[model samples]
Target: MKRLFLVLALLSAGIGFYSCTPEPHFDNVPVITFESISKNTKLDGFGNKTDSLVIAVKFQDGDGDLGVSSTLKEDSLLYKTTYNYQVRTFRQVKGAPVEISQTISNSGNFPRLRDDNKIGPIEGTLSRAILIYPGTVPKNDTLSFKIKIMDRARNVSNEISTTQVVVNQ
Candidate 1:
């Protein structure tokens, strides 16, 4: 009876560990969707705040191929994460709303790979924070954002846009 109890305990531990880890990826490309965006305003040395936007997203991949191949080389940094962003700032113009647009691709790895040789679907949430400097825009201006991600197969996820945010000075 003691031997049987020990076996069951070990089996339970193994299952718990497996469920917490990321599953292997199959051949299908990963899919990601926009979740939410919120601002983290902090005061600088001059007592002025530069907006830090936290972007949240949900992702699923049949073949867990969403991250870089390796983390040792310079090339790995380029393919690891495909966090892309497009921003538009709205100004209160005389007649129509004046707007400025900018596009950017983030660098570095997000560590979204399986640890074993198995192949299966993986799903999780990814969050990134970016600092936005309100250079020329006047106070009370508004801004919007569009974002997307890519998988190892170079499959681009559906683009998502954030709601209008007031430029807090």
Candidate 2:
């Protein structure tokens, strides 16, 4: 009985110590890290044969205000400039990489991560699919992408780049 009581006491003390641990501290500005990019290509649509790739990134924000509500309305000018996530594409040309013309808008908003009014740090991974349609670039082009995220406060996160990948393969 004494041995069982001692074990129980030790378990309770461990639980109490864990419960007293504080949350991790993070900066107010968002920070993002490149997680991965899908190597295998998938069909963009049911019937369409165009290839698509997915890029994933992990992000952390101290204030937990990292996304926007779909119902929120704003001026067209403001809306155009406000994007929760931005992705820039680069293609290998000769021996160097060049930024492609901004014909496709890969930047867009993400749903609010936290719904409650309570402010706290939050972190999560975000993945986005990019289409590699015909005529966009030469077939089997070597490409890489730069990604960044913005919090609801318009604080931009550090940019990160993904490994080079062959598209339309």
Maximum-lDDT candidate: 2
- TM-scores of the candidates are 0.63, 0.85
Instruction: Check candidate 2 and list the clashing pairs.
Output: none
Please tell me which predicted candidate would have the highest TM-score against the true structure: 2
Error of 1 at 67 (Å): 1.8
Model 2 off-target regions past 4 Å?
1-11, 39-48
Q: What is the lDDT, from 0 to 100, of the residue 30 in candidate 2?
A: 97
Predicted candidate 2 versus true structure: per-residue lDDT over 3-111, tens digit per residue: 9999999999999998896887889899999999986554554654576788999988998987885566655665677788888889999978898866777788787
Off by over 4 Å in 1: 1-27, 75-109
- In terms of lDDT, the poorest run of 10 residues in model 1 is 79-88
Error of 2 at 103 (Å): 1.5
Model 1 lDDT per residue over 1-169, tens place? 9999999999999999888966455436666677888888888788787788787878787876666445435455444333322233444466445655535433234554666745678778878776666564567666665556666567766666666666665
lDDT of 1: 0.63
Provide C-alpha RMSD values for all models, in order.
Answer: 6.6, 2.9
